[model samples]
Target: MRVPHDDGPPPPPRPPKGRKRPGERAAEAGASDMSQEPGRAALSPTVAGGEAGESLSLRPQSLAEYVGQAALKRKLEVFVRAARGRDEPLDHTLLHGPPGLGKTTMAHILAHELGVRLHLTSGPAIEHKGVLAGHLTALGPRDVLFIDEIHRLAPTVEESLYSAMEDGRIDLPVGEGTRARTIGFELAPFTLIGATTRTALLSGPLRDRFQIIEAIEFYGDDELAAIVCRTASILGVPVSGAAALEIGRRSRGTPRIANRLIRRVRDFAQVRGARSIELADATAALLELGIDSEGLDMLDRRLLTMIVENFRGGPVGVEALGASLGEPRDTLESVVEPFLLQRGFLLRTSRGRVATMKAARHLGLELPPGWQGALDL
Candidate 1:
């Protein structure tokens, strides 16, 4: 499908006869307007060496391209089709919940389905009010501004966005020093697509500003298997169906992890005098990588061990646990913690992190001090 280059109908009147032709003026005008948009040029900035022509954007493009989250796909399709028909943005969509579940890719798909340009950037990239204003100023009507990790938007920068999202207006300083006055610039009716793994950190007002809150849930066995198989095919790896399902079962419900595992397994198979991935070879390869059949990596098991042994299988604070295990809090929280918690291996208490009975029993360990009381409750 062709991208919608025309945001709307052409400017009504041509330039005067003495002036440059309307087409040249239009081109110049577009160039001038586009200069203010970050990540909005004809080319996208290098993401994980995508500048080298590698498929670093990694995320899929459509619901069919997106694996898993079937319910989300159904809802998104309705919203996409309806929004497209009305010629209005879908909404100020906020994608919450854990990472690596195609939140960013879904945003791109939403933009693509709407036939609008997708301007990508992160929350931290816009440091000041002016920078945020400039970015919004450059957006065409009904364009998409994807702000990844939206919970990290600084207070001042977030403040600058209130009016932008609410009224499609941005306040800019017209002059310097005492002579300066704030000027309100009208913006196109655009969509603010915010994504975050940590929705709790967002202010209440900020959360309310979003028109929709869609949480990306973990993938199921079938979804993960299909994702692995499809991803392997796309990367030109010869993968057996069983091997694909095996990899997916071990992917811990994450498509990104499934893709990563496929690559690792492919590498292993290539070096081990094998041209194709079979169940046995895949199992052995995964064993070497320290990813078990349960989809738990060695670090994941180590984290469980830390919780079971060092933290006493009870209420252990994340900071204290991270310090003991040398794990970054955010990484532990976003990647490892989500899977563990989802698998019913860990419990989040009002006090702190506690290993579930399943976790203790899985490790063949006894429950520790504090958990005994909570278990009774």
Candidate 2:
């Protein structure tokens, strides 16, 4: 979304008939300018290398192309077919998950399946009521508005969306002083797809507005291997099944990470003048990138090491750990902790985060005597 430029003074409240309005011209300009910006406005975040990157993006344009989240895909397929049969917009959907699990890709697939235009924006991008209003007013019937990181929306901006989402209209105050009056503008039917990593941060009313709430889980290793193979095909690189599986195993169960590893492995193979990616190449590439067999990167290892060594096997607070590591608490909780806890390296308790015995073993650290009793192990 483009913020209109100020040129001395604002345009007249009403432009002469047959002439374009300032707002219309600004919107047109924004549309044209979108191509110049790589990762802004309606452009997919996963896209890189500008237009070339868009063609190579691993994002699935349809549910048939999307991998994993099998149950969610089946549900969406039924919903899309039903909505199309009734000639109505799909219900507002809330997709919650950890980052890079294809929440954004799912939104794109929804729009494509419904055969509608998608307006992409983020919670933090819509700063106020006017920005929200601009998006709402510009929609055509059955179009989609995808908001990423929806939990971060400003309260006032979120409030403005209630009527639009529920009533298909928006109420805005017009004029000023004693002449001030409220205007309600009717809007076309539309779908709002919200993606968030932190569902608990959303207001109850906002959460209730969504008709379909789906949780996107991490991909299984097999599913990730399939995604890696598909990505390699898209990149025109040859990859062995064993290489793909190895990359998948080290991707931490995320397709985005799997694709990234594929590209790095391809680069490594190309540098070595190898004809195709092999298990040895994949292993060497990941090791060179500081990823261990357990898929733990340097940061992950550092977190575990800090807990085992500095915190004495950890019954430590995330804030304290963040302070010592110079990392944000949110990053620790959202990014590092989830994977570690999933892999049994860390445990969350009422008191704080604790390093499990598995973490000590992984780090090759020896706990003091009687540690089992102290940690209730």
Top-scoring candidate (lDDT): 2
lDDT of each: 0.81, 0.87
| Model 2 TM-score, 2 decimals | 0.85
Candidate 1 total steric clashes: 0
Q: What is candidate 2's lDDT per residue for 1-377, written digit by digit as tens?
A: 98898767875577788889778899869967874655432212233464368344767889999989999999999999999999999999999999989998899899999999999999999998888999999999999999999999999888889999999998888899999999999999999999999989999999999999999998888899999998887776788999999999989888878988888787778667677788999999999999999899999999888887888876789999999999999999889888888888888988788888887877789887655314634
For each candidate, give its TM-score against the true structure: 0.81, 0.85
Full-model lDDT, candidate 2:
0.87
What is candidate 1's lDDT per residue for 1-377, written digit by digit as tens?
97667678867786677798768789879967875655442322223432233244456777777777878889989988988889898789999867778878888899988899999988889888888887898899899999998888889889878888998898878889999999999999999999998888988888899988889888898898888877666665678889989999888888878878887787777666565788987899999999876778887888888877887776788899889888889888888888988887778888888777777666677765566423733
Q: Give the C-alpha lDDT of model 1.
A: 0.81
Those runs of model 2 whose alpha carbons end farther than 4 Å from true positions after fitting are 1-56, 372-377
Count of backbone clashes, every candidate in sequence: 0, 0
RMSD of candidates 1 onward, in order: 13.4, 10.0
